[model samples]
Target: MSTTVWIILAGALVTYLTRIGGDLVLSRFERIHPRVEAALNAVPAAVLTTLVAPVATTGGVAEAASLVVAGVMYLRGGGLMTGFVAGAVVLVALRNLVG
Candidate 1:
């Protein structure tokens, strides 16, 4: 309906296509090169950094604190889901209290 909606839909479509394309291409290969496998393994962390770094840089204290909490949680072996939930709780609590 709106430009933002169209952009979101387009992004979703592209993301889906890229995921399926990657799977298809990898399936055709009998064995992946060690370098290629290492690069693929690094993709998730790279993507996460790209997504978080911009927001953490430009956001307010609440956002920054949430990111710090999440990072610490992960570093302390809290696991992904626990880190995410902890960050989300901090974000919501700070936003509500500060605002």
Candidate 2:
């Protein structure tokens, strides 16, 4: 097999193992501890910040405004999906306005 094929197979195997390992670990616990629960809850927000912070700082007003709307929606008790929709709608509207 070529190097590219080997790399692809290795990547797939690693990804599969990661998913399985997470499931196995969580399943073994009858009830997660409060601290663990808190850590788990923080993961999504941390990931979101890392993913969005760069583009949000560098992008145009539409991007910045969309992030603000999404953040506010989330803080106001909207679901993640709702926040995503709010951000996307704002971004699209602003893009059209700017264009």
Candidate 3:
């Protein structure tokens, strides 16, 4: 097989194993510790926050401003979708204005 084909096969195998491994492990385990369960449940939120923190904190002027606007929208009872849309709009508008 070509290099690209090998790489694609490897990626597919990895993905399949990851999905199957989670199911197999969870099915085998009758009970998990409360702390472990809590940590597992919090993993998604922690990952998302980690991914967004840098963009929200250490970006250019436009990004920083948009982060602030998004944060305010979130604080004012706006949902995740609303905050994301507001931030995107702010970023795009500011980029255009600056350019």
Candidate 4:
């Protein structure tokens, strides 16, 4: 196999292993509490925030504005896709204006 093929296989194996590990751990607990469920649901957004925060902080005005718009839209109960679109539009407009 080529290097790319080998890398892809390794990544797939790692992903599968992680999923199995999580399932194994969760299998011990038949039912998680409502609060735990809520926290679990928030994990994706929390991770996304962590990923974006550093870039937004270090980036120019447009990046910061985009982050603010995305966050506001999300907090206002907009769907994830809507929040992404709103942030992207703001970022594009700001970049065109300032860049």
Best by lDDT: 1
Per-candidate TM-scores read 0.69, 0.62, 0.81, 0.70
- Full-model lDDT for every candidate: 0.93, 0.92, 0.89, 0.91
Q: What global local distance difference test value does model 3 have?
A: 0.89
| Cα-based RMSD of candidate 1 | 3.7
**Candidate 3 lDDT trough over 10 residues, lowest sum:** 52-61
Q: Among these predicted structures, which one has the highest TM-score?
A: 3
- Model 2 clash pairs are none
Off by over 4 Å in 2: 1-3, 20-42
> CA shift at 24, candidate 1, in angstroms?
2.1
Clashing pairs in 1: none
Return the number of clashes found in candidate 2: 0
lDDT of 1 by residue, 1-99 (tens): 999999999999999999799898899999999999999999999998898789789989889999999989989998999999999999999999996
Alpha carbon RMSD to native, model 3: 1.9
- How far in Å is the alpha carbon of 6 misplaced in model 3? 1.7
Candidate 4 wrong stretches, greater than 4 Å? 30-42
Better of 1 and 4 by lDDT: 1
lDDT of 4 by residue, 1-38 (tens): 89999999999999999879966887799899899889
- Give per-residue lDDT, candidate 2, residue 99: 51
Error of 2 at 55 (Å): 2.3
Cα displacement (angstroms), candidate 3, residue 55, comes to 3.4
